[model samples]
Target chain A: MEYPAFLPAGDCALSVEFGDAIHPEINARIRALREALERKPIRGVREYVPTFRSLLVLYEPCVLGFDRLVKKLQARMAGLRGVAEGKRRVYVIPVCYNGEDLDFVAAHARITREEVVRLHCAPDYLIYMLGFLPGFAYLGGLDAKLHTPRLQNPRTKIPAGAVGIGGEQTGIYPLDSPGGWRLIGRTPVRPYDASRAQPILYAAGDFIRFAPIAMVEYADLERRQAAGETIWEVREA
Target chain B: MSSGVDRTLRIQSPGMLTTAQDAGRVGWMASGFSRSGAMDLPSLRRANLLVGNDKDMAALEMTMTGVACIFGCDCVFSLTGADMCAALNGQPIPRYTALQARAGDTLACGGARVGMRGYLAVAGGFDLPAVLGSCSTGLKFGLGGFAGRKLRAGDALPLRCPEIPVSRLSERVLPVPNALDAHWRAQRPGMQLRVVLGPQAAHFTAAGVEAFLSSWYVVTPASDRMGMKLEGKKIEAVCGYDVISDGVAPGSVQVPASGQPIVMMADCQTTGGYAKIATVAGVALPLLAQAKPGDKICFAAIDVREAQRLARREAAQLRRMEIW
Candidate 1:
């Protein structure tokens, strides 16, 4: 693979662009560079924000100049071997397909509610990156049949753990906030819990599979989650 | 008040949107958190310095309107940023100067006369617990700073009381003009912000880039802590406005499909899908923060090296003020 172009984001930050579009290989390369930087930490590197096709790095100008920082990154990239593919964690999240917009999504897709649930559960969606809101994972690999447009008028508040789809992507809302996605199901497990050692549950390379559950099971899982019990079953992907 | 325990401030009223802010929350962007801090960072640092607090110490960030609070114990405090016509016991207090307050004394602040946000820093900084390595409030995520929300009436904020006598230090320290205050005053009538042409500068037409540099953009009422939306000449794009979502930094000038620019601020989202035409230089962020609705701002494109030089110069100036 060709080395990514290092573009100046601003005086304080720089972007290492992997490609123009989002692809699994491009994302893996981005994550590889991030992991490399983490292992051999660069001086004055403050933040590393990984996206679909690039990694935005913020640094203090006082400690490290932009040119020098880019040189260090380039040197690291030269030593990086084939994409560092670690064992990706697959989380089994329990979801109840009884969302307020489930019927709307079914009608829009020209399928029954049962079909909607099946299509959603079939794929182990890849976690692209986390953004928009805290713990909100941008998942790719949604079934082409489930591709639906966002709401014309977004709802004011989407509850936490609400599974929704917008365009080619489907994600879980980690917090109650105004969103434009079409909600088709609700998950019992919290994607974000501040009290946890690691606040966010999943990383960029992880995979998530939705396990359809009944209303009774959803209520039981919700109760267990509130009591600080692990709800999602995790295993090596 | 107890003799040895920490001092505190009882909020009588929180005007507009008052939240505890510091330098910023760093190293958390990967977890989808923005570095939410004071919009006018220079002012916050100056206010903290005046009260002999750490430069990045937590302070009250008052927006549009100021706050009204009563001192639970004796302390020295300073007000900086927007001159909100602050008063101590009905008598007006001067901006950028530290004043001693006794227990039960009320500090009332009125609406800003010039800038949008104001800073109130106490002697030893607020005793707020740092969440995720920062006390700066991230209101969207509802984390950090005084219960991770805006300061409301009846909220009591604990202060780190000085072990030594602060009275002597307060008297010895004279009010001096800080470099930040001087730089802010120097750019009075002309609101020109220096920006660096972007990582996606080629996405716009030459005419669009020219329009952005030459035309004036008015600050719209839709502006807030998240971003400042501007209404001005349309910046036509050559290859449309959408981009694969990417990580956004503060002061990014993102132009959407509508052609209008939105300057991201302190509490902006971690990632955005709009194409960024330019990024406002770090040194000019304070100036942009002070701009209110209807204010007209012109952009001047500077090279990345020049932006770094300006940032370094500002840092040097701030360091020089330590001796004064």
Candidate 2:
């Protein structure tokens, strides 16, 4: 693969563009660069934000100038190696497919509600990135048959743990806020908990699989989660 | 440091949008957290210096209006950023200078006369719990600051009192004239913010880029800490506006389908799908922070190297003040 183009984001940050389009290969390269920077930390490098096809590197200009940082980043890229596939963790999140927009989604896809649930749960979605909101995971690999457009008018408030599909993408809202995605279900697991040792439950390269549950089980899991129990089951992918 | 004395400040009236902030929450963008810090960082550092506190010490960042609080112990403090017409015990106090306040003294401030935000730094900084390695408040996540929210009436904030007397040191050390001089320039209207063409500059038409540089954009009333919405000539996009959601840096000038540009600020999200036309230089970010609604702004394009030089010069000047 050719070296990514380095573009100046601002005086304090630089964006290394791997590709113009979103692909798993490009995302893997981004994750590789992030891991390299982490293992061999660079001076003045304040933060690393990885997106679908690029990595935004923010640094302190006082300690490292833009030109010098660019040279260093280029050298690092030259020696970049592909990340070896490790034991990836797949989190099984329990969800009750009884959201307000379930019927709307069913009609839009020209499929029954049961078909929508099967299509949604069949694939282990890849976590592309986390953004838009805190703990909000932007996941990929949604079934093309279940692709639904976002709402024309966004709701005033979408409760946290609302699993929704927007176009070809699908995600879970970790916090309650106004959103426009088509809600299909609600998860009992809280992806974002400030009281937890680690606030966010998922990372960029993790996989998530949804498990359908009954309303009674959903209520019981909610009670268990509120009582400080880990409800999501994790296993090596 | 002894933890004997319990010094505190009772909030009599919490102004518009007051929150506890330090330098910022760093190294957490990967976890989906924005660096929520003082919008006007230079002023925050200067205010901390005036109060003989560390440059990154947590202080109260007050918005357009200022907060009113009563001190439970004698302490020295300095007000910076905007001129809020602050008074202590009903007597007017000057800005950019450290002043002593007696126990039970009530400090009040009125609407801003100059900039958009103000900083109030106590002697030893506010003694607030750190969340994710910062005292700065993340309003979106409700993670840090005083209960992860803005200050309100009847709230008492604990203060870390210094061992040595701060009032005595105030007489020996005076306010840095260079720092104050730069702040004066920031208060002036019609700021020309320098920016650099972006990673996606090719996405826009040549005329669109020209219109962006030539037009004077007025800050919209919808502006907030997230971003500064600007109203100006429509910068027509040759390509579509949507892009694969990517990382957004602070000071990024993103042009959505609406044709209007929005300058991302400190509280902006980690990733955005809009195409970026330009990004404001780091040295000029403080100027954008001070700009209030209805303020006029113009843009000038500079290369990445020039932007880095300007940033270095600003840092050198701040260092000359002996604050950091």
Candidate 3:
């Protein structure tokens, strides 16, 4: 509801709110703040977790006080420029719309399965944040027609690479976890690999677009991934 | 904690939930990795220091129950936190003290004697690779720890063997009194954790906030390292329960539509969409971590500055004890 409200997440952290809703402008502002902090490291701030509309800044209580840290952050915000207005990285992920809930989503939306798949792969979804699981990107900007409620009875274990929709959100499960999201498809490429030097595939403030593939193509991509090939493509524009 | 190993700990019977943990995995929260680490950090440090290892070295974090492990080499070890009635080779060993375990010695650890979790630290620390910069187990994503899972039977943990035998070197005893220490004594009359209400305090009605502070809650059976579900007075919300998804820290008390509060723990997700009412102070985490299921809990509102002061005091106390 408000912009720039410094609230205590705990004694050691502060959640700096930019706005109440998930909007591109608010997310851009958070990304700007994060970039500024990274460029010029804060004295006591350890890490910054940028979410839909807030930046959770974690610091050591023994090193700095809450009020003093807020004051320092205020000064930084006052002089902040449009850093996030520049180039936004994009991730092209391939998915096969052969998930178990494909027919269910189509029936609920009162559209054909092809139409549902078309709507799902239409937009370049904005990765608002990564949470719940490691490298599990929380993407925004799903088609209104495909906005379906989660399963009444959540599934016990949704496998990794399953593209899912829950409420007004959509994302990919990087790991197998018990979740309530409606799965529409599955991706062979992993958003997260613990053994990788980078570990995570993408970051917050990036754009993710789904590329539809046939069942045979999915098998090919899966085989490539298994053979140590980078399936996902990253384009900087 | 240092590289190079000479000994190994072979698990004969894996307890209820036992895993290796260190301080935690940091600098990766933005990527959605949970800060999974030792629940009772103070006890972890004490146990590690007692065994002549670095304070934050990877140690066995036994929850509720203990493991039946066998030493593959002669080494020194120590146990802390909730006593699990541990015995080396059929002889009972004391908590918070270093002991000598001969090669092939069978160390059996029973259920918790007091608190809900315990820590076992060996002399040279376990020779586990640091996944994502920490040895802590991230159970959610199945990363870190021994093959990214809890301790199970047939898992042999490679560890560094102590260079000197017990007969050659001086005995390693902690400087602090081994009696029911100050920390445990203060938490005897049930758990009363301090809270700093905010971040989403505006989302809740004043009466709802009042109910939360004035009520006593019970930890439900459905609880784990991720979060503790507390059932008590229903904390009402204003319009709706859902908030725009945001980052959540450990100890965040998130209240959903059901009016129940789920206090995030050491292994909770990095972000959550539920509206958080308050966060328990860092100083109270050790006590909260030790709280067992069915334990009564009360909340006391404390200013953020005061909570920070208490945290500083605890850190100072630990540092003072570390000198010995």
By lDDT, who's the top model here?
1
Cα RMSD to the true fold for all candidates:
2.4, 2.5, 3.0
* Residue pairs of candidate 3 with colliding backbone atoms: none
Give the C-alpha lDDT of model 1: 0.87
What does candidate 1's lDDT look like per residue over B1-324, in tens digits?
457543789999999999999999998888788899999998888888777777899999999999999998889998988889999999998888878998889999999886888999998889999988899999987899999999999999999875446765464233433334454467654488999899788889999999999999999999999999999999999989999999999989999999999999999998999999999989888888888898788899998888888888878877865653
Q: TM-score for all predictions?
A: 0.94, 0.94, 0.92
lDDT of 3 by residue, A1-237 (tens): 556899998898999999888888889889999988888888888888999999999999999999999999999899887458447788889999988888888999999999988999899998889987889888889999999899999999999899988887888989888999999999998898877778899899999999999889999999998888888888888
Q: What is the Å distance of residue B174 in model 3 from its true position?
A: 3.5
lDDT per prediction? 0.87, 0.86, 0.87
Model 3: per-residue Cα lDDT over B1-324, one tens digit each: 333333689999989999999989889999988888998888899888777777898999999999999988778888898879999889998887888887889999999877888899888789889988999988876778899999999899998655445554225666443222554566655567899997798889998999899888998889899999999999999988899889999999999899889999989989998999999998787777887888878899999999999889878877876664
Query: What is candidate 2's lDDT per residue for B49-140, written digit by digit as tens?
Result: 77778878889999989999999888888898888999999999888888888788999999988778899998888889999889999887
lDDT score at residue A192, model 1, on the 0-100 scale: 83
Model 1 ranges off by over 4 Å:
A1-3, A107-112, B1-6, B171-189, B321-324
When summed lDDT is taken over every stretch of 10 residues in candidate 1 chain B, the lowest stretch is B171-180
Question: Distance (Å) between predicted and true CA of A194, model 2?
Answer: 0.7
Minimum summed lDDT over a 10-residue window in model 3 chain A is located at A80-89
Residue A162 accuracy (lDDT) in model 3? 96
Model 2: which residue pairs collide?
none
* Candidate 1 residue pairs in backbone clash: none
Q: Sort by DockQ, best first: what order?
A: 3, 2, 1
